[model samples]
Target: MKRTLVIGDIHGGLKALIQVLERAKVTTDDTLIFLGDYIDGWSESAQTIQYLIELSEKQECIFIKGNHDVWCEDYLRIGKANRTWLFHGGALTFEGYQQLSDEEKKKHLNFFERMKLYYVDDNNNLFIHAGYTSMKGPEQEFYKSNYNWDRTLWEMVLTMDKRVKKHSVLYPKRLKIYNEIYIGHTPTLYYNIETPMNAINVWNIDTGAAFTGKLTVLDVNTKQYWQSDNVNELYPNEKGRN
Candidate 1:
């Protein structure tokens, strides 16, 4: 049977991405849903995007837009972003991007342009780069900006006591809207978790690949996951935004 694999924030860790794919034993028939943040941090942002472009050509892939990705896109189109983007990891992305040819830049920019803020699969599973609030489905159009930046939804999931029967009262009906929700952006490392974590109906797959953790890819149907070696190990000589 064909499988759907959801990937976490890559953050330009191209080596980590390759390792995770190898560990997952990905097949061309498998569907890959990337939770975005494909650039920033590591030194391989340009190569990472190019690889994803090639992967899409032969494999089923869905790319979701992440906040870092939005920053990169904005910088490419208008040459501007907030200081957070510039100081955090955007400078590294810019350096990597500068190494690309003009044609490569155009192609990568187009890929960013085509990315979605969120996606809902036939199984009613929501795949988003970040969280979503407004208690509405993806089609409801509550706040377009929040589609790639919201953290409240995932935060709510983290704080609610899943062991309690009354946990439903803590969140909106939207919390129950999907059979499962997979997201990246807020790294699991912030919660002291170094792997994919399940909270309520949400799965956080960002294992802080941009920082001290590894890249992660999870099979949506089986809940089986694969992880890369520590991202820092892949780029031993680089500071990687630290």
Candidate 2:
């Protein structure tokens, strides 16, 4: 059977990304679902996106829009650059982007523009870059902006009891929306773990590649995961998101 490989935040760590992909043994027959934040930490942000674009031609790829990606889109669209975004490793992305040709810049822009806020596959598996706020499924008419910005969704899951009855009552609508939900953005390192974590059916896969953690790729169906060495080690001389 074909597999679906869901990856975590890349944060411009091209080496880590490549390592995880090879470790996972991803193939053209498999579907690669990226939770986003592809750029903005390591120095190879543009190169990372370029690699993904090339990968898409060989396999099925689903790219989700991350908060950092939103910052990237804003800059590409209006030439607007946010200082806060810059401070959060966006400068690295800007630097890498400058080395791209005009055609390459357009390709990157198009890739960012086409990313989705959230995706619910036929199996009711939800893939999103950040926590979502609404409980009325992905179609609810809420602030669409929160799709890539909210934290309450995962926060609630993290704080709630993993027991079924208790969680069902507290997050009844949320749990009813999908069989499983996978997200990036909030790194697992915040919880002191450097691997994908599960809580109340939600999987937090951002292993803090932008920090000192690793880049992770998980098989959504089998729950088997693979990771690169600590992201910090991959770039011995360069500072990550700091």
Best by TM-score: 2
Clashing pairs in 2: none
Against the reference, the lDDT scores of all candidates come to 0.88, 0.88
Query: lDDT tens string, model 1, 126-225?
Result: 9998887766676675788777888888888878876755345755677778889999988888888898999888899999999989999999999999
Query: Which pairs clash in the backbone of model 1?
Result: none
User: Candidate 1, which segments miss by more than 4 Å at Cα?
Assistant: 79-82, 163-171
Distance (Å) between predicted and true CA of 186, model 1?
0.9
Report the poorest 10 consecutive residues by lDDT, candidate 2: 162-171
Provide the clashing-pair count of each candidate structure. Answer: 0, 0
